[model samples]
Target: MTRLVGYTRQLAPELGPAADVEALTTAGAVRVFVDDETADPRRRPALTDCLAFLQPGDVLVVPSAVHLSHAVTHFATTVTALETRGVAFRSLTEPAFCTGDEHAVDPAQVLAAVEGLRRRLVSLRTRAGMASAAAAGKRPGRPTVMTPEKVAMAVELRNLDRPITHIARVLGVSANSVQRALAPLPRHPDSTS
Candidate 1:
């Protein structure tokens, strides 16, 4: 008997109106694995569970190829792993990848197509996000933690011959932060001598 299993990383509100499990059930999935409150692809416990529950001849179905993986390499690796385990894959959104279909399509070809599509989609989304951030006058990286005052204090403490650890302790910051804060200071000529 063939088992149809589904997996998803997102939950209720983020998954939108139709629940993922319900949608998977509608798509003929008998069992579903959902990772609750997990956003990181690397930390999907439910995905691991689904993989563990899989048996030979079972089919793993997902709404989209992205649900399997966001990265092309990781997607390919996952597909290969499934293939090796005798488990087939099907993407409801990308019907070409469906192994259960009557049409005989090369899995490699499907993988390539999905990879190209994922790359384009990721690139488009990234560009859109960057453009939005630029429009909002916001920088793309983490906000600076070392303020000018902190830097000045670090420099002052360094000049006073305070150790990096002591300075960090006094300022409630890391020793690495103290070191980074003092890195740009002009060296005293006497100190260099």
Candidate 2:
């Protein structure tokens, strides 16, 4: 007989929907491995326990594909490892990709979906990190070396038809910096007068 095993990353039971647990329970999942208090997958003790407890006919059930992994390569590797151990994978939210079921879905399609989800998750995490940094008054990327005084001097020299190399030498700044500052500023409609 195939044993049902559940897994989750959240610590608190309230954090996960009751419906998800109910679904797993209905699917005959008797054991659950939860990685509470750790965001790092490398430090998940409960997951280790689940892995050690897994039998050849056991099926690992998860609430969603993201719950299994947010990384495409990791997800694929984990699934393949389980398959090699004679264990199956099932996601309540993604029933079509359940290996425990008799329905045969293309492995390539599942990999494509995993890759798409991984890309979207990575993009969202990057955007959130940038927004958080901005909120903390931190600027992203390299700091500008050009000062307003230097920019003004470059602009004046350029307006006087000075050669870019000559302007750069006089200002003691790079030719690239001089050229960038000398670029024409956009005129506002109100400043047309």
Candidate 3:
């Protein structure tokens, strides 16, 4: 009999017991290896052990597709290795990989998977950009805090050997605020300030 393994980045508070219960109730017909408290299956040592535990034609089931990384090369390599071993994949929440014939264990499925991965990468980039903007004291989806005049003054003050504290005090802001405001100014880039 083939096995079904579920991989997750740490079991959910609400779903942890339920997942174990469901796996245990599988009646010993399909050995279910439930790896708990993992970051990513790719990084988990248990995943290597689980892969070794798998026989040809075994299946790995995940709850959602996004649990897998959004890196196309990474995802593709993983899927290819599993396919080479005749180990199938299933996402319970996404019937495409679980039930759809065209999507189930087919090379064409890579396109859809790649597209999904691309979308995920885009979203991750967007979130990272927003976070960096916030750290720089700029609000996301808003006009920049440093106007042209502000940047010019920042460069002028910085060149004048004025300490960041003094500049910020004069500018009516924090030292960090001044640093951030002046960060965009060319730092000797192309010999320009």
Name the candidate that leads on TM-score.
2
TM-scores of all candidate predictions against the true structure? 0.57, 0.59, 0.48
Q: Residue 83 of model 1: what lDDT?
A: 85
Q: In model 3, what are the clashing residue pairs, if there are any?
A: none
lDDT of 1 by residue, 1-193 (tens): 9888998655222455246678788988998887654345567777888999999999998877766674777777887889888898888777766664354887888777777668755874586577669879998876666788988887777777778899899888888877887777875554531
When summed lDDT is taken over every stretch of 10 residues in candidate 2, the lowest stretch is 184-193
RMSD per candidate (Å) reads 12.2, 7.0, 11.2
Instruction: Put the candidates in TM-score order, highest first.
Output: 2, 1, 3
Stronger candidate by TM-score (1 vs 3): 1
The lDDT of each candidate is 0.75, 0.73, 0.60
Clashes of 3: 0
Which candidate wins on lDDT?
A: 1
Query: Which regions of candidate 3 deviate over 4 angstroms?
Result: 10-42, 98-110, 125-193
lDDT of 3 by residue, 39-146 (tens): 443566655666677667677666555544436676567666888888877665555445322454555675675577578667755865777698899878856556
